[model samples]
Target: MTLRRRATGLALAIATGTTLALTGCDAAKDAASDVIASATAAVASAAQEKMNEIKDGVDAAADVKAGRTSVDGDRTVAEITATNPKDKTADYTVMVNFRDGDGNLLDAVVLNIDGVEPGTSKSGTARSNRTLTGDTTAEIAQALRH
Candidate 1:
């Protein structure tokens, strides 16, 4: 074979191999991205499920109240007060929901205040389970007295 022909053939082969190798790298990158996206979706779904569990609770809105929400570092916090009107001391399971300005649920936290005396109010702090950003407010979602 002629030297010029052999050199051209060798160059063509190298170009083809490089192109295939780059295509394989792109495919690998795409697969990795898909896995990361799926993992992220799973984590988000689990978080929502946990919040829904808190939603399945008793409603005693008349006896409990939530204060304005504040941000302490990356965490959202709020004050909760539970009034015991019963004849005996009772425990309170309070669910505080943090929301955005448009009333979207950002996070929910349960605060347990036990042994509240009759005709008195017990105060406790409720904090977000994860870091929250942007403007947020807090409201009472559910409260159970026992």
Candidate 2:
């Protein structure tokens, strides 16, 4: 091949490699939508775990739930539902967050539940430290069935 042709090919390969490397770094962090989706799934899984705990085994499980967020004066309140799916009582830790229209987190709080009876659903609320305005969103950050 000509010397000029070889030089051009090497430059193109280097440029392609550089672009791929940069793109990988740019997408290093999770996107807002991806975070939201994962959080939603986790919250739903917690709820289902509680609901199905009452069943004889883990193989028997059903149900899904969503969290709620509302503005109450100077405090933003977030509520997430958890269930005791087992035949016995249980406890769970739930984390809730308040966000604005742009998906910016305004506040977050952790909630706890004790003595949740079998086959029952209980709601836990987290109040933000500061007030929120404009469009607000509430999501469950984490829920652990204990």
Output the number of the lDDT-best candidate.
Answer: 1
For model 1, the stretches where C-alpha displacement exceeds 4 angstroms are 1-59
Cα lDDT tens digits, model 2, 98-137, are: 6778887644555666667899987767665444567878
lDDT of each: 0.67, 0.55
Where does model 2 exceed 4 Å of error?
A: 1-66
Clashing pairs in 1: none
RMSD of each: 18.7, 16.1
Clashes of each: 0, 6
TM-score of 2: 0.52
**Candidate number achieving the greatest TM-score relative to the actual structure:** 1
Candidate 1 lDDT over 9-31, as tens digits, reads 43454345445556668775565
